[model samples]
Target: MKVKEMIKENNRLREQMTPFNRSYLEDMILVLRASRVDPLRTEELLLEAAQQMLIAQKKGNTATQVFGDDPEAYFKEVIETTPSRPARSKLNYYLMIPWTALTLLFGVMAIVGLISEWTTGSAGMFGQISLFTLLSVGLGSIIFIEMIMKWMSSLSDTDAPRVGKFNIKGFGVYIAIAVVVIYAGLYLSQLFPPFALSPWVSLILSIAGLLGLKFIFLK
Candidate 1:
C-alpha cells in the first residue's frame, strides 16, 4: 500500500482503539509487515495482535484490549475494502533486464576466456573477469530471489486455500523454513569454494524461479 494510505488507515484504526490497544496494534502491524506478511489480512492479523496482547496480559506484561467486542467484523470489513499492497513489478523487471543483458554479455566473454585459457594454458585478466562475472551473476540471483520472495510474501491472497485449521494451515511454518534455508545458503556460500561461481548459480535459479512465479500467478 501507498505510505500515505497506510498512514491514513493506521490513524483511523488508532482513533477507534484505546491508547494501549492502539500501541499493540501498531506494533503487530509493523511486525507482520517486517515478517513479510500481508497487512490486508487485517482480521487475522488483528486476531494475532489480540492474542499477543492477551498473552502479555496474562503474564502481567501488559493489559490492553483495543476492542471491547470481537474485532472480527471490523477486521473483515477492512480486509474486504482495502486495496492490495502495490508491488514493484515494473521496477523489478527493469532491474532484471539489465542484469540479464549483462549476464549474456559476460557469458560470451567467459566462453572466449575459457577458449583462450585452453590455448594459452594460462588465465590472464580476461579469465579473472570471467570468474568475477559468473560470481556476480550467482550472488545477484540469490539476492534477487530473496527480494522476490519478500515481495510475494507482502501480498495477500484473499482467496487463499484453507482447511480445518487456523489461517492457511502451516503457512507460518513454510515461511519460517524458507527464511532459514535462505539464510543458511547465504551463510554457507561465503565459507565455501567457488564463491566465485555462487552468483552465476544463484542468478540462474532466481531467474527460473521468477519465470515460474510469473507463469503460475501472472499468466
Candidate 2:
C-alpha cells in the first residue's frame, strides 16, 4: 500500500485497540515517524504493528508484551538498524509542504477574483507578491527541511528519543542561519523588482506544480 493508504488503515485499526494498548501504540508510532526511517517504511512499520497489536489484543496481550517493556529502547534499536531514505527523496517530501501551501493560497485568491468580477463587473485588483516576500517564503521552506533533518540526525547520533521530537528547540539555530540566506537572495532578486504572476496563472501553475510534486516526491 501507499504510505497515505497505510496511514489510513493504521488509524482505522487503532480504533479497535483497548485504550491502554492504543496509547502505547501511539507513542511508538510518534517516535517511529519522527525517526530516520523512510516515510514508506515508517507507515509500513506502523500498519504492521497495528495489525499485530490488534491480534495481541484479542489474545489478551498488552502492547508492552508485544512491542517491548521499554518502547524507547525499541525505538532506538529500530532507528539504529533501519537506514534512512535517500537525501533526494527526503528533500522532495519537504518541498511538497510549501508547494501545497502556495497552491491553496493561489486557489483562494483566484476565487476571490471571480467574486469581485461578478459583483462589480470588474476584475479584482490582486496585489503582486513581492520578490522579497517570495524569498522569505522560500527561506522558510528550506529552513523547515534543514531543521527536521538536523533533529533526526541528533536523535540518531544520541540514540535518545528526547533529543529532537518535534523540530522545536533547534529551530532558533535554523532561523539564525535562514536570515543570512534570505538577505542574500533578496539582494539578488533586486533585478526583477516588479516580477509577478497574475491570479489565474499563479493558481494554474500552483496546481500543476503540486501534481508534479505528488507524483515525484510522495512514495
Candidate 3:
C-alpha cells in the first residue's frame, strides 16, 4: 500500500478503537519500533492485536480488559519470546481518577448527611431509609466502578488463568467498616447533636473534602 493509504487506514482503525485501546496500540507501536522489529512484521502484529480486540468486543469485553494489564508489556514479551530477532529494545491507575473522585464525593456527602441526621434526632424511619438508600447506591456505584477498573488492570498479568475470584474478603471488610461507622454515629448522636449546616455549606465541604483526598492520594 502507498504511504498515504497506510496512514489513512491506520487512522481509520484507531478511530474505531476505544480511548484506552487506542492509547495501548500507540504505546505498542513505539515499543515495537524501538525494538527494531521489521515494519511489515510490526504492522502484522498490530493488525492481529486489533483483530483480537474486535473479537473480545464481540465477546462483551473491552479491548483494555481483553488485552490485560499492560498491552505494551505483553507485546514486548511476545516479541522477545518469539524466534524473530529483527530488533532489540526495552519498555494508570490513572483511568480510575474520575470514577474515584465521584465515588468519594458521593460517599462523603452520604456519610455526613447520615451523621447529621442521626445527631439532630431527625433520623426517623423515613429519614433513615432515605439516608441508607443514598449510602447504599453511592457505595454500590463505587464498588462497581472499581471492579471494572481492577478487572482491566488484572489483564496485565498475562499468565493468570482466570480473572480471579470475587473479593469476598473485601466485601467483609466493607461490611465491618459500615457497622463500625454506624455505631459511632449512633453513640455520638446520644452524646452531642451535630450543628446544622446549610445545604450549600454542606456541598462546599463535601467538594473540599473530595479534592483534599484526591490531592493527598491521587496526586
Candidate that scores best on TM-score: 2
Evaluated at residue 169, the lDDT of candidate 1 is 35
Per-residue CA lDDT of model 1 for 50-158, tens digit only, reads 5655566555554233432333333445555655555764444445644554556555546555666688864455443343344445454555555555444443322
Candidate 2, 9: how far from true, in Å?
2.2
lDDT of each: 0.50, 0.71, 0.56
Counting clashing residue pairs in each candidate, in order, gives 7, 0, 4
What are the TM-scores, per candidate, against the unseen true structure?
A: 0.25, 0.68, 0.34
Q: How close to the true structure is residue 99 of candidate 3, measured as C-alpha lDDT?
A: 41
lDDT against true structure, model 2: 0.71
**Over 4 Å off, model 1:** 1-19, 27-67, 82-192, 196-219
Which digits, one per residue and each the tens of the lDDT, describe model 3 over residues 1-219? 644455466667877776666766665656665455555666767767776776676677776687766666767765776565422211023334444555455456556666766688453332222333434444455455555644554332233345555666665766676666566556656565444344344456557656755675445
Error of 1 at 186 (Å): 11
| N/CA/C clash count, model 1 | 7
State the displacement of the C-alpha of residue 154, model 1, in Å, after optimal TM-score superposition: 18
